[model samples]
Target: QIIEAIESAFGDGPLSGRHVIVTSGPTHEPIDPVRYIANRSSGRQGAEIARALRDLGARVTFVTGPSTTPPPAGVEVVAVETALQMLGAVQGALPADAVICAAAVADWRVANAHADKLKKDPSGRIPTLEFVENPDILATISQMQEDRPRLVVGFAAETSDVLAHARAKRARKGCDWIVANDVSPETGIMGGNENAVLLITADGVEQWPRMEKSEVARRLARRIAEALAE
Candidate 1:
C-alpha cells in the first residue's frame, strides 16, 4: 500500500516527535437550512496530505469541513461546517511544526442567515441576501504571535495568472509557502484526481510537473519532513 511504502522509506518510527495541522474542504455559509454558499473542493487532496504527513512520522490534527472523502487513519480529525468553525478548530490545533491551509475557503459568507427558508410570495417579491467577508484562515494562522508554525503553506486556486496571484497571496498572507494552481473552468482540477501545482517560496517559484494528487502530497510531505528536520 502507499502508506506502507512511505513508512518503509521514511521509517516505521512513530511521529512522537512533532505535531502538524491541516485544513481542508469547503466551508458552507448558510443562507438557511436549505440554502448555502460553498465551493467544489472535495477535501480529497487535503486528506491525502494529512495521510502522507502521518506516514512520514508526523502527528497530524486535521480540521476539515463537510466532505464525502473519509478522514485518513492514524490522525486526529475534527469536523466543522462553517468558515468560523474551521478557523477556530485550526487555531486550537496550532502550536505545530507546520500548518497546511489546503481548504478552498470561501471569501464571503451570508451577512444574515435566515432561521427558516423564506417562502415565495404570490406577489412576486424577490428576497434579498447580504454577504460579508469571511476571515482569512490562512492569513490568521500564519500571523499568529505565540505559536506560529515554523512553516506555513497555503493553497492558491486561481483561474488566470495563477503565479502572479499566488505570489501576491504569499506576501499578503505572510506565509512561508504557497502552492499555486490553475483551476480554470476547463481544468476540471477542482474535483478531479490530477493536479498541476507550483510551489512558491521566498527564494523563488518552483514549477512541478502535473501529477496525481497523491503524488503531489507525497512529494510535498517529504519536503516538509526534511524542512522540519532542519
Candidate 2:
C-alpha cells in the first residue's frame, strides 16, 4: 500500500513507467533439514539498488534470499530461500523493463537432502553425498528469446583478476553489463560498507572509485535511467 501511494504521488518521475526486478542475497541450498550451504553475501548492495530505483520512481520488485539487511520501502518484496526459489520469484516478477541479478547463488545442492539431520555413526562410518548444479538465473533471463528485459545486469565477486573474470562472465551470461568487485579478505569488501567496483560492458570497462554502497546504487540507478531512456 505504501508503494502504491509512492507511485501515485510521483507518477511523473524519470523512471515512473519502468518496472525493475532485482535479485539479492545469498541462496541457501539445504543439505539436510537443519544444515544448508550458502555464500557470505550481505545483500546490502542489491537492497540499496532496489531503494535507489524506487526513489527514481520505478516500480521495483525486490526478490531476495536470507539477507541481513532489510528490504527497502516503496517496493514490492519477495522473500525466498534457495536458488530455485529465487529464480522462480524473479521470473514471476517479470516481464520487467530491467533485471539486476546480484544474488550469490550456491553452485551446487545436495542431491539427496535428508529429511532429518544425519547423525554420526558409532562405528566411525561417514555418509557419502551427491551434488547437483543449481540453475543459472542470470543466464536464463539474459538468453530469453521472449519477454526478456531491455537491460540485464549481473554481479561478479572475484578475489583475483576482477576485470578478466567480469568480462568473461558478461559474455558467458549474455548480460548487458556486469558489476565486478574484489572480495578478498584484505579488501574487506565482502561485507564492508564501501566498495570499489568495475562496470564491464561490451563497449569497455569503467573503474569506479571506492565509495559507499548506497552511492554506488544511486550512480547505477542514474545510469539505468539514462540507458532505458535511450
Candidate 3:
C-alpha cells in the first residue's frame, strides 16, 4: 500500500528506464537424494524488494533459490536450487542497472554429493564430509568486464560487530553497498517478519529503525530508483 502510494505520487518513469536484478532465498547444497545443506532464509525480504521495485516501474529479474514463496507479480522470476545454478542465472540476467544480493547463499557445498542416503553404521564411525567454497555471485558480477550493474548491494548476516563485518564484506566482494543485520540466535531475524538493519555504502552508514520487511523493501527500492536516476 505504501509502495503504491509512492508510485502514484511519483507518476510514471520513476524506474521505467532501469533494469534490476534481485537474488533471494537459500541455495540448497545437495548432500543426498533425501537431504541437503540449506539455510533458514524464507525469502520474504527479497520477494518484497522485488515487488517494490516492480511497483516503482523497474524491469526486475528475480532469481530465487530453493524456496516455497511465490514470485512477486510483474517481475520475471527464475528459480534454481544449488548455488552454482543461482550463479549461472544471475550471470545470464545481465545489463541490470542494479543488483541486490539478498540470497543467503551457502558459503560451502559438499565436495562430493552422495547419490544415495547413507545408512547408520553399526561400527559407529562417522562418514567424512568434505566441503568446498561456493561461487560468490555478487563478487563475480561486481567485477565483471562489461555490463556490470551500476550499483551492487549485498546483505551481510552477522552475529557481532555487524557494521565492521559489513564493511569488510563490501570491500571483499567489491560491491557498492551492503545491508548489515544481526542474526544472532535470539534475534530470529533470519526468517522473521521484521528486522533492524543498517544500510552501508561508500558514503557512510545509515541506521534504520526496526520495521517490517515489506516496509524496508519499499524504502530500499525507492532509494534504488532514485540512485539510478542520479
What tens digits encode model 2's per-residue C-alpha lDDT throughout 83-105? 98998999998899999998888
Cα shift from native, residue 15, model 2 (Å) = 1.0
TM-score of 3: 0.93
Per-candidate TM vs. native? 0.92, 0.94, 0.93
What does candidate 1's lDDT look like per residue over 70-114, in tens digits?
Answer: 999999999999999999998888789999999989888999898
Error of 1 at 161 (Å): 0.8
Model 2 residue 22 lDDT? Answer: 93
C-alpha local distance difference test of each model? 0.88, 0.91, 0.89
After superposing all C-alphas onto the true structure, candidate 1 shows an RMSD in angstroms of: 3.5
On a 0 to 100 scale, what is the lDDT of residue 26 in model 1?
A: 88
lDDT value, residue 140 of candidate 3 = 93
Q: Sorted on TM-score, highest at the top, how do the candidates line up?
A: 2, 3, 1
Please tell me which model should have the higher TM-score, number 1 or number 2.
Answer: 2
Which number leads on lDDT?
2
Lowest summed lDDT across 10 adjacent residues in model 2 is found at 1-10
Model 3 lDDT, residue 106, Cα: 93
Worst 10 residues of 1 by lDDT: 1-10
Any residue pairs clashing in model 3, and if so which? Answer: none
